[model samples]
Target chain A: DAGITQSPRHKVTETGTPVTLRCHQTENHRYMYWYRQDPGHGLRLIHYSYGVKDTDKGEVSDGYSVSRSKTEDFLLTLESATSSQTSVYFCAISESNQGREQYFGPGTRLTVT
Target chain B: AQTVTQSQPEMSVQEAETVTLSCTYDTSESDYYLFWYKQPPSRQMILVIRQEAYKQQNATENRFSVNFQKAAKSFSLKISDSQLGDAAMYFCAYRSARNQGGKLIFGQGTELSVKP
Candidate 1:
């Protein structure tokens, strides 16, 4: 409902391979975030971008990288996939300066074997 | 550092009945925000309600309301006249009003079921 869409809704990749998930939003929100959801550990932020070429690490930023060149697109890349990286990745956007109500994308499920 | 905790792993309620989900957070900052998000089987995250720590009065939206006790650091969600659509995993999250860039810290989550 927030005009957010995630590409490659489901993906399976072998260990040590490179994978990248894309999040595209039409709302032109100023802040975009990437998160991973796993059992027993709610959604953990992977990385986030406040504006073009500006990014910051989150609670769980290891083994992942992100880049944003435009306001509508945010990309999360797993340099080398691992079994531990297998989980559902979500993308969120917020218009405010502080973390407030964030609209989420459909989510991408990536599997590393 | 801020943390959110949802003690209940699972809960069930009969349709048309009222059920409350518990959530507690630890934060040194006095001004912040608390939110309740519902993720149904479809996995779509829906915002149920939100409460600003600065506001003394609780926030409500239709059937969903929150009990915010800032002093106790407690935030709970109450669903009245629960329906089958309410069956989902509920998450409590905290966001600092300071310079966190709106980054949210989420709880473990509670799976709620509504039985007919």
Candidate 2:
């Protein structure tokens, strides 16, 4: 309900192929995040952006890169998809006044074969 | 490094009954925030409740409440008169007070099943 949207709800790709996931928010929030969910690991942060062209690596940023060229759009790119990268990815946005209650998009289920 | 821990991998509660989910976090910052998010079968993360560390009073929404013990470094969620719709995966999350980017550290989740 936070006006967040993620493109390509589902994707399947072969190993060594490149994949990109996009997140767009209509609320124009300044904070955007990318997270991946896997069994035994609830959700791990992959990357986040605070402003246009301002990004930072998260705990599991290895093999993943993100870019925020505009306030409402953030993109996550996997240079070479690997089987280990198969998981459900979520995009979230938050307003500074909300104090960390992030509004999440539905999610993207990616499978790498 | 701040970390959130949810020990219960799965839980079950009867309709109209009460249930409590345990969550513990380790953080060096005195001022921070804790949150409980519910992810249904649809896998969409929804915010259920939130607690601020600086506040001594526990936070409560309609049927959901939290037992925030700062001394014990514990933040547990309690659902009273649980309903069937409560069935979902519950996650505990932590965020620093000094940060404004809304970066969260999540715990391993607890899958809750509500029975009739």
Candidate 3:
């Protein structure tokens, strides 16, 4: 409820297909992050952005890419999606400075067939 | 690399009872923060409590409190008089204070069930 929204709350795509998930925030936070949640493996970071056009790969950045063109919009793309990529994705935003409280939006559940 | 560990996978507590969830972290940085997040069936992540490493006093919010032992690298959440609404997947997270940017290392999570 931190003015964050994830588009395509539920998606189904086939293997080898391209998919892009969008995270939009209204808080104008400077930091945005994308994460994937799987059973037995909490939430694993995929990519994060500190500012417009500034992005960094996370621990599980392989096979995934992200772009932040505006303060509110952060995009995550899975090129040639694989079945292993099927999982629930979450978007988080943090205000500048301490960035202590990272408010999360409702997750997006994606399925790769 | 920093790591958060939640040794308990599942826990159940009767309504109005007290429950404690254990979490331990491994980090070299002396300045950091710990947090407890709750995710219910709705799949929304909710922040329950937070503790700063530099703060010696435990943090409490309503019926939720944290026993943060910085020297022991242990952080535990105690829910008093648990309610059915408290049932959720609880996650322990660690964030380093060295970097101002947002990055959280999360534990696997502990599913807490509040029985009627």
C-alpha local distance difference test of each model: 0.94, 0.93, 0.93
Tens-digit per-residue lDDT, A1-113, candidate 1? 89999999999999999999999999989999999999889999999999999999999999999999999999999999999999999999999857469999989999999
Clashing pairs in 1: A98-B102, A99-B102
A-chain TM-score of every model? 0.97, 0.97, 0.97
Question: Sorted on DockQ, highest at the top, how do the candidates line up?
Answer: 1, 2, 3
Q: DockQ winner between 1 and 2, please give it.
A: 1
Give the poorly placed runs of model 2, Cα more than 4 Å off: none
Clashes of each: 2, 0, 0
lDDT by residue (B9-94, candidate 2, tens digit) is 99999999999999999988898999999998988899999999989999999999999999899999999999988999999999
> What level of docking quality does candidate 3 show?
medium
- The C-alpha stretches of model 3 lying farther than 4 A from their native spots are A97-99
Best by lDDT: 1
DockQ of 1: 0.70
* Model 3 chain A lowest lDDT segment of ten: A93-102
Residue B34 C-alpha lDDT in model 3: 90
lDDT against true structure, model 3: 0.93
Q: Give candidate 2's TM-score.
A: 0.98
